[model samples]
Target chain A: MSILVEISENLQRGKAKVVKELVQQAIDQGIPVEQILNEGLLSGMSIIGEKFKNNEVYVPEVLVAARAMNQGTQLLKPLMAAAGVKAVGKVCIGTVQGDLHDIGKNLVKMMLEGKGLEVVDLGTDVSAETFVNTAIEQNCQIICCSALLTTTMNVMEDVVKKATEAGIRDKVTIMIGGAPVSDDYCKKIGADIYTSDAASAADAAVNVCS
Target chain B: MIWTREQYIAHCNFEFTGREMFCELFGPLLQLEEEWRQQGASEKEIAMTAFDWDYVLKTGLPCRTGAVTGLKPIILEDTPDHTLSIDNMGRKSLLHKKAATIPLPLEYPVKTADDWLKIKHWYTFDESRIDYGAIESRKALRDKGYLTLFSFPGGFDEPRQLLGEEELCIAYYEDPELIQDMLETMADTAIKVMERVCDKVPLDNLCVHEDLAGKSGPLIGPAQVNEFVAPYYKKVWEAAKSFGAKIFSQDSDGNIEPVIDAFYDAGVNLFYPFEPAAGMDMVKTKQKYGKKFCIKGGIDKHVLRKEKEDIRKELEYKICDITKGGGTIFALDHRIPNGVSIENYRYYVNLGREMLGLPPIQGEGWQRMAF
Candidate 1:
């Protein structure tokens, strides 16, 4: 197999240290940085994401693969910056107010970064005002809200309403997901999208950003 | 005839305890109690008739079951709506003080082998950790038909509490030694502590709790279960089983359907609060496992937020054959969320009990779980 395929396989198996070493080797061999990133790192993570959605792999596997991808990508950051390769889009994400749970939120953030988008993690218990202000100031194309509580999920609507009032509703896409979030609820709250799992959420965000 | 907590467990194991029984593994959200009071319930009425909680009695034996016993969280910051605290285990979390939601974990206790070594001292079995007086009282209660449970952190859950979710999963692959040490220390600690408890009184239910699954399935699969969990779990569980823990039970949330065999193979004969939204069906599970295993919760908890007719429909379909078939303790899949009002909740309990042919409730729906 090719060196790029080797890096992808190692990453999928969660061999972070090995993936880093192999990525550096590929870099030294004069492979294009974007090719190494797209073929070596993101390609592996994309497969993990698909596996995660289909239950072929689970949280642990997905998390480690994400970690490995991050490891491989860390080596390419400077080179990519020199080459002026830009991210597809930027997004801001958080768990909504009164809901402190963040496992799902963090997973989606990693998947977003895996999809070559810059994600500003606002952390948990984020209010609607903060989400809107952050998106406005950061010039993000998408805002993602997550809540794990039935009580706290109502805050997603406030986020939607705030974006509308702030006049960014038309400018930025809104994404929502968590244990209690649904496509029907997303529509009811006037949010743009709701995907069931992290991979699908990343895929949806890519769609919105593009 | 009324039966001991032991007998109730026995009946669920297909051992036939004179009569079939109706019980639950959990209670209302307790945060919803304030709302219940606002909905015209007197404080006295609420206390006396706490959804008939004791009617289908399952009393957990007051033994020290946490990673480290008797350590309260140290307050670091106090806001009007949230609190930032470091738990005794040295994990930092942000709490939504008013809402009573699970605190968002900001930092975990263990990150590396050195971190595990720094904290390993806390896992030892100390005499002070055992609650002797509470154990004596609950032990007496157990013999008098209250199902007494000897509950502890499951092998997977113990390490997860120390390592946090993300690190724990990665540690299973990258730092196998750290995971093994954590699991081994916990298993040894469990055995030593449980031996002392069993010497005082026999345990009816050996309850291992691991909130290890999600809407998708278990965080770790059967392969991980066999690799990281089962070997140590088997040691502690078998010791409890040998010590007269009639039912080896586990409590996990979200689609545990996939890993039931891993748990069963490790000697768990009973499970609780099987989430329906996550695809756990009582009828299908019964068809598969028959009466060999016991299931406590499967009724859709989300349905309680809806109208009475919806609640009735959910119950009628889920419980028609579950209760009569044996090896079952009827309950909602999880706690009652705050969205469910007192009136709707009472209707659920009363209507649920009536459907199971259990005793009905008193006026104003302040009755307990038992008749």
Candidate 2:
């Protein structure tokens, strides 16, 4: 079987070890790094994301599959780097200021990374200044802010305002999400986008990045 | 006879007669500040503010119209400063710094057997920390009107916090003996703490806070709970009972149906904040547990943030359906997030009172209830 197909199968079954082994075999077999990534690991993750969106798989399953995909990616990273492969997009992400909750944020990050976005994670309790600065430093095309608390969600506006004040708002797309966050909130906050779930977020990120 | 807040709320509703009007109290945690910020709080920029204990004591209710206060040590330093970030899809992403403070057993606490031994000495019962004067004031306040003491830090999930999820999982198989020892130690400490606290204050009910489940299900399976959690809970419950505490309650977030039997077996007579995320149908739990258990806080926090009409509908559905048969108090399944407008919260509270047949919150006769 093709190495890409094997990697996809491993990911579907959540066999991290098998995925890792198969990726190594593919690399050893001289499969192009990008091909292995796109057709193998990324393809598998996309399927997992779809299943997650449909509720065919839940958090644990997603986490396990993500772990497997990550393992597979590890084998391909050096090869891809050597081949001068660039990330599909550069995205800056962080939990909004004053909010330290990260479970949802982490999941979204994993999914985004799985989708081949070069994510600049700003971590939890991120200040608006930090997000703006990171976006500039990373030359990011997208700025995503997460707030899990109603109190902290207000920071999304501040981050957007800061981006605007810095004259970087038009330069980058701003996205916000969390449990308390909604599309209405995103619109109200003047954010460019909002997604309720991680997979949707990843897909959205991919669309914007592309 | 000891009167619980549930009983008091019921009595004020005229569901019971002559039951004292003890107000329910929820302890504030530092985590709430982050939750509030995530919801878009703009007022306070500071972390680790103290909760207005005085305000809570004065009002006789857990409701407070001021800034929440609490101190939480940072646990993760290795992670970045941002709490939540969005991805390219405009989806918010979050990463908890490794430096973020975790519950003791779960993240920050004793990991190895040796670490346990070192920390064992710190667990000694400290009586001086017990504010007998405050307890006396609370009791006096109860006499004048009604007051309920907030729950302390004992619950099924507390030990898990101390044990850390990953290590605890490993300990279950790799080191059962150590796990048993840790549980025993926790039980001993819990019993001592309860005994000390109750000695100072006559508790109507003791709430044990633990988030045993997530949106999906319980963190630990039923068999593990039976083995690791039940015995320690029994110890705490027994200790509370000995001190004349009437209700031994647990506050766990998520659908706990899978472990409801374990809760009952552990002598947990009351359960609060039944999260609907795990498909928690309070009406079903009430039917299953019946009078054997008293439930509090089954209203969905998410729904409370909805439009008034929707909020009212949800309130009616939850309160009417869940409490229809009996043995339930209407409360938010969790803390009322800041996303829930104050107006909506008041609506919920007032609606709750109306449903319970309690007097209007603002009135001359309000002094009569004194809750």
Candidate 3:
């Protein structure tokens, strides 16, 4: 019956309206914004993320849970800003060039955002230079690339090369993922990380950013 | 030597499904036709060439129905530039000009049971259009010695596409009846169209295009598939068979391992273009369901871009074992993209022939029968 647990449970159930109401109530009760964010919304989302990674839940569950998280995040954003609190990390993500598939990329973006990360969604068919330049320009701590096709997965290599050329290769962790991408391909491309699913990608992004 | 139709059919166990060559790539295929003629290759010598219902079907129902209802697919946007448009299926999609193969669906028309009811009205078969002449036209193709393969929309892919994947997946739990209603509507239209086609001409084979999987596996898990897709498939398959459908198959893009058995039991005896990138293993699949179900595509299309030897190695594994008893067909898991040079494709095809103890196709790049 604890306030945070209630928020977490409501968020997990994808009762976005309920989660938002509880968050506002908790705020009125003088609960710390950071605690509500980390313990309530993000905690619920992290569980959903793990379940998604484990294949116990699928995309729709993750999407609705993330929606609830977003509802709670919106109510807390003004307070967090007023309190001088900041997002955990900033990252840039996109589907690689020649690959127009964005469902996987969008899923990863939502998961990262649910984890309290500021994600700059570069969208699908993004060039390697866009990813590299955006990372440098935005001071992103990580560059995440996704590709759904084997033919376009090589574009991830170009992204790594672009980051290296931009001279932020060491500063920004490069994460590659999608159906055809593998750990071997990640290593071959010299990317820092590769995760099979969106949740793991988000989990890795958090680690890389921190 | 040119092979006879019976020998070719026996060699591959009637595993041939027609091509889905991109609209743009049709030019290249036509050009290849001229080159093929110059090289002394007869019409029958070209295995990929075929005339089928997908190209001629008037009512786009059961196969890409966006254009069938007399609605021109308004190009809401142009491609390679995130061209957004409402496709023929009353679904909004972000289509790319370069990759015109599959569009990313953004909005779906049917989500709730109410939505399903409204959309069901759009799936009407025009009896005037479905007259005996429709079958007569196809029968003419069959009379020309071309094997007549017919296809209709499998109930699942059409409704899933109409409802978008996310909504459809969630609807399985939230509105299972809505899913059933939409599927039943789809089967109704399919049975009517297919019955007309079957009543007119003997169907040599049937392909139900269901791109219902991601790279990993079925978008919806096996249980949902059994509950939602299986019965609809059984209904359509039985209707198609009653008229005279010899070979039945499902044309899905991604790994279908979860629903492979379910599809086989539903009378879809063949699964085509088994995408290797999606973890579809021909060797393993054949080892398990080879006797009951035949497979068509397993060669990873990406391998064709690699060195010739790499392409050979990719084909070598499946050529002998899978195709030993005419239970498998040699094809890219999906369409051969423009990225795959004509030379590579010709090489792959000739290599398949060489392995099958058939004569190799002789040509060079941009030359007769080459890229």
Candidate 4:
């Protein structure tokens, strides 16, 4: 098997040390930095993302695999920057205002990064104005909002309204996901997208950008 | 009409014994107490009794010098905006005062086996913690027609909350022995505490709080629950049963359908706040489980936020069938939210009573969860 395949397998297994070593060996083999990043590290995470969406794996498994991906990505960053390989899309994400829950938002952020999308996470309890402003300022293609409470999920409507008011409504795709958020809610609020879980959210974000 | 003592007791025993409400919604009710009274609602104080766990165990651990099985929460700092405190679960948090929600956890106390061992001594059997005088006073109040319930914050919820969800889940994989040790120790603590209380206190019911589910399903799956949670519950129910405890119920939020059978098997006959939004349907659950399991709180709470037609439709859909099932309690699936206006709540309550064949409460409706 190729060294790239080994790196992907080790990353999936959450073998961080083995991933780092294999990533270095691939670099020694003079493979393109983008190939190692896209085919090796990212491919592993994308497979895990599919597994997660399928319920073949769960939160803990997703979390550890993300950790392995992070470790390998850290090693590749400097080289990838030198090669001038840009991300497929720029996305800004956060939990909506008055909602302090971060688990869902964090998972979505990780999955987006795993899909080779550059993600700017604004963390939890972010206001509608901030979500719109950050997306515009950062030139992000997508803005994702998360909420855990039925009460707080109403804030997503404000996010949609504010994005429209800011005149960036056409430029950015607003994606909302959480326990209370449904496709009907997304349609009701006039947001661009609503995916049930993080993996699907990343995939949809990628599709929106394309 | 004034309710007789037996009628009230039956309400508390067989029907709902109030519900856990959000402080935001509860705050306004306190202001309208007098208005409710003028509307013919009865006000009664229920006496709660329990052996002081700290005084009994006498662990003398950390800041705590007594039998309380929980951590000796210390106020590390306080400010108008936030209060940084180490709570009883041994998790340090900076509580945001304005939001009235829990503070962010800065650190968890028990991460390893040694941490569990350090806390283990706090739950030892302490005879001195048993307050006979206190037990007698509560029993006398019960005799005088006051509702009395022996509530114990159980093992699974507290342990998981204290340990932090991610850390505990990691510990389940990395250190199964450590997780088992903590749970078994906590179970023993609960058994010991209840055993001592039962020896002296005569209570109406044994209520255990375990918020273990979420909107999707049980936070921990059935297999994990069977391994870690079920045994502890079995021990608790068996212990309470031996004490002649008549009613054994548990309060949990979210869709608990996943673990409902496991809970029933472990002797939890009653479950509360069957949150409809979380996919808990009173009629279907009643059908599947039959009359063996008692259910509380299945009314769609969101109806109050909508129009009166919505409220009527939701109640008419859920109430008649659930009430006929014999063990179903007529209450909102969860606490009334702040979105529910006093008028809407009053209407909901009056409608519920009308469906149950009880007289309508006067203007403003009843405040407490009473007959």
Candidate 5:
């Protein structure tokens, strides 16, 4: 198999050791960094994302797979830097203001990063202003906000409003999610996208970026 | 001072006893802590801050109570700032400025087997920690013709929190023998804590808090519950019942309906914070169980963020309709969030009180769950 395909398979199986070894082997073989990344790590993550969305796999599986992918990416980082490979897109993410939950946000961030997006995690309890400012400063294409509580879920609307008020709404796509958020609520709040889970968030972000 | 089940239910004027009523005052988890920290509040202050309590009262719900299960302290060392430092299950580690500072315990008390060993030794059965101040305050309120209840703590998740989820899951699988070893250790530690607390305080009810589910369902299957959790629950339930406690309750989030029979068999008379997300239908569950269980906290947490009318409609549809002939407590399915405005919470609280026939609090609406 091609070195990229080998890495992708290892990642899909959540074989951290194999993923790292294959990534190093790919580097040793002098494959282009972006090609290795896109074909190997990102492709594996894309499959995992779909599996998760389709309920073929669950959170623990996704998390372990992400861990393997991250390990492989760690090995590819310097090579990618040397190749001057830029990220596919820059995305700013956080759990909305007043919410301390991070599992969902972290999952989304990891999946995004696995897909080769530059993820600027604003961390949990992020305010609308903070999201807007960070999106503007980071030149991000997407502002993804998460909330685990019903009360804190409303902050997604405030985030969208603040993004518009800051005149960056037109420049950035706002995606809101969490346990309590729905697509109807997303449209009601004027968000650009609403996904039920992390994989969907990743696919939507990637789709929007492309 | 003597109260029968009917009188107690009448006093609260709600069907369920231990359920929580939530008024969504805010949207999904916002950084209220950072906002508080930026406002120059101490970490203790930030942790103790209430979310939309005023609005919860305004809603006029019959019950108005919140539990403090997530206030445990964690000692973080060598963790970097900005990057999230979590324990194995991805729960955020507490950041304390000083080691000497005794912050409120927010998370689970146990972390590792070694940590559990250390805590087991250092764990004291201090009856004084039972928050008699709050109990006394409630007692006073009750004396003055207002109904009140105290929160219960410790359950299956408590041990899991101490042992970590991976270790516990593994213990259940590869090291079945170790499950007993760990459960014995946890049971002893918990028994001591319960004995200590019950000695000093007149507990309204003893609650066991265990979050045994994910979005899909319970983490452990039913057979595992029978093997690992049920025996320990029986022990704890018997201990609590022996101590003159009237209600022995278990608090678990998600659709715990699958194991409801096990819970009842284990002597848990009440279940709190019945998550609607997990498809816990009180009407159906009560019908199936047939007074074998007391239901609490079945209202969906999501409804709190809807408009006042929607909130009312759901209250009538989900809560009132289902709980009509059952032993039910009116409460939010989970914690009140900051996204719920003060006004909306009050409206819900008021509605809860009116429905349950509880006396009106001056500022709040109606009352209160999770594991």
Candidate 6:
């Protein structure tokens, strides 16, 4: 089998060490960096994302595969940069203000990255102004906001309002999610989108970016 | 309306009371206290009125069921809004004093087998860990007509304490042997502790907090739960049941419907705080599982944010039929969030209380029962 296929299969099995070694080996063999990324790393992650969507696999599988994908991608980062291979999309994501909960936020960020989006993680307890300013500064097309608390979800409305006040509401797609958010809430806040789970969020982001 | 322990036990087992047993299944969120104070109607006053009017109360038996007992959390850093602390499990967490959110786990203690080996000694049960006096006090607490429970962390929850949710999720696949060993050892310790507690005082309910699901479904589906979670539940629950514990209940915050059977089949008969926003159709759950399966909380909290009419519809949809034959307790799916008008909240409660045939919550001798 080709070395690229080895990286994909090893990453799927969560063999992080093996995947890292194979990614480096693929580089040494003069394999195109983009091929190793799209075919090797993202290919495996896309499958994991689909499995997660279908519940054929669970969180642990996705988590381990993400760890493996990270291992492989760390090797490809500078190479991809040198080749001038830009990300398909860029986004800034965070758990909204007054909410320290980040488990769901982090999971969504992973799924977003799995879809080949360059993510700027603003981390937990992030404010609306930060989400807006960072997205503009980083040239991001989408802004993702997450909150686990019902009380904290009010901040998501502020995120949309801030984006509108900053005159970028039409330019940036606002995506909202977390345990307390829903389709109705998305519509209520006038955000661009809301998906129930991380996999769907990633798919939605990719669709909007494309 | 003051049902004895006999009535509460009977109601849990699917016996119909004459009307809905007046109860609130979950506690108020501490984060909303400031809002409540601002509204000029504290839940404390509401709770006092609830009891004066014969509301059924619930509380837990104080039990130190952690891997290591008597180990206090050491504050690493203290700030105006948050405090960083490390516990016996060696996890570093940030506790927000002002925000009612849960402590965010920063650094996990157990990742690999070597880490498990290092912490294994803490889980061992000994005479020093036992508090016979506390057990006796629990018996007195139960005798006060509170729906008393002996609650502890479950298989998934205990390990989640050592490994944060993300790490624990990955560890299930990465380190099955370590997971199984930790669970089995914890179960052994749990069984040991429950055996002694049950021996001293008769058990009303034996509860294990799993918190193992989310908005989509259970974090792990039935197959993984069967392999990883249910076995320990089966063994430990059977031991507690053998000690005359009448109810084996599991507490999970999100949609547990997927693995509910796994827990039910493993001897757990009751569940709580079922979040309706997460798609836990409690009425459907009741129809599917029948009267033998018990539930505590299923009222949609989002309704409390809507019109008074919407609140009535949501409550009637949740409370009416499900409570008809018993095995159900009415409560908001989760905590009352900030911004729900005090008027709306009181309306929801008094309306529910009236539906249950309890006196209005307008305090002593006030006759605004149908406002």
DockQ-wise, the better of 4 and 6 is: 6
Whole-model Cα lDDT per candidate?
Answer: 0.79, 0.64, 0.69, 0.69, 0.63, 0.78
Q: Write the per-residue lDDT of candidate 6 for residues B1-371, one digit (tens) a residue.
A: 45566676787798876656545444456655566667787555444343333344455555556677446888999888888888656677887766655677777778778988888878877765567767767777677876666665578888887877888888877788888988888788777877777776666778788888788667777776888888888887788778777887777888787788778878888888788988898888888888867787788877887899999898778766655667886667666666677678778878888777666655531111100
Docking class of 2: incorrect
- Tens-digit lDDT track of model 5 for B132-152: 445455444444443223333
State which candidate, 2 or 3, has the greater TM-score: 3
Q: List the residue pairs that clash in candidate 4.
A: B53-B67, B53-B68, B54-B66, B54-B67, B54-B68, B55-B67, B56-B126, B56-B129, B57-B67, B297-B333
DockQ, in order, for the candidates? 0.58, 0.08, 0.31, 0.29, 0.08, 0.58
- How displaced is residue B352 in candidate 3, in Å? 3.1
B112-191 per-residue lDDT for model 4 (tens digits) = 77877887676555665466456666656556655445555454566666577666655555677776766676666666
Q: What is the Å distance of residue A204 in model 6 from its true position?
A: 1.2
Model 3 Cα lDDT, one tens digit per residue, B1-371: 22233443343353433311111112232234455556665455344442110112111112322114555566777744457888776667776544344677777776567766665667656564354535565566556544556566665677667776666666675678887877776677777777666666666566677877776556665566678888888887787678665567677877677777767777887777787877898888877765676676677877876789989998788776545566665456764443455566567766766675543344311111100
Q: Which pairs of residues collide in model 3?
A: B62-B153, B66-B88, B66-B89, B80-B97, B366-B371
Q: Tell me the tens digit of each residue's lDDT in model 6 across A50-103.
A: 877877777777788999999989999989989888788998999998788777
Relative to the unseen true structure, what is the C-alpha lDDT of residue A33 in candidate 4, on a scale of 0 to 100? 93
| Candidate of highest lDDT | 1
**Per-residue lDDT of A87-198 in model 2, one digit per residue for the tens?**
9999988987766666667778878988999999888778999999999987999998987555567889999899999999888999887756778778987999988678
TM of each candidate vs. truth: 0.91, 0.64, 0.78, 0.77, 0.62, 0.89
Residue A210's lDDT in candidate 2: 90
**lDDT of candidate model 1 versus the reference:** 0.79
TM-score of 2: 0.64
| Off by more than 4 A, model 6 | A1-13, A17-33, A82-84, B31-63, B76-80, B87-90, B134-148, B357-371
Instruction: Between candidates 2 and 4, name the one with more favorable lDDT.
Output: 4
Model 2 spans > 4 angstroms off: A1-22, A35-71, A83-86, A165-171, B1-117, B120-181, B187-206, B212-248, B253-269, B275-293, B300-311, B333-348, B361-371
DockQ of 4: 0.29
Expressed as tens digits, the lDDT of each residue in B114-204 for candidate 1 is 9789878787678776777777887777667776667766778888788888788888888898988877887777888788887777767
The sequence of per-residue lDDT tens digits that candidate 3 reaches over residues A1-210 is: 988999998877777888999999999999999999999998899888877666566665766778888899889988998887798899999988867777778888989988889999998889999999999899999999998765577789999888888889889899988877778789998999988777778888888767
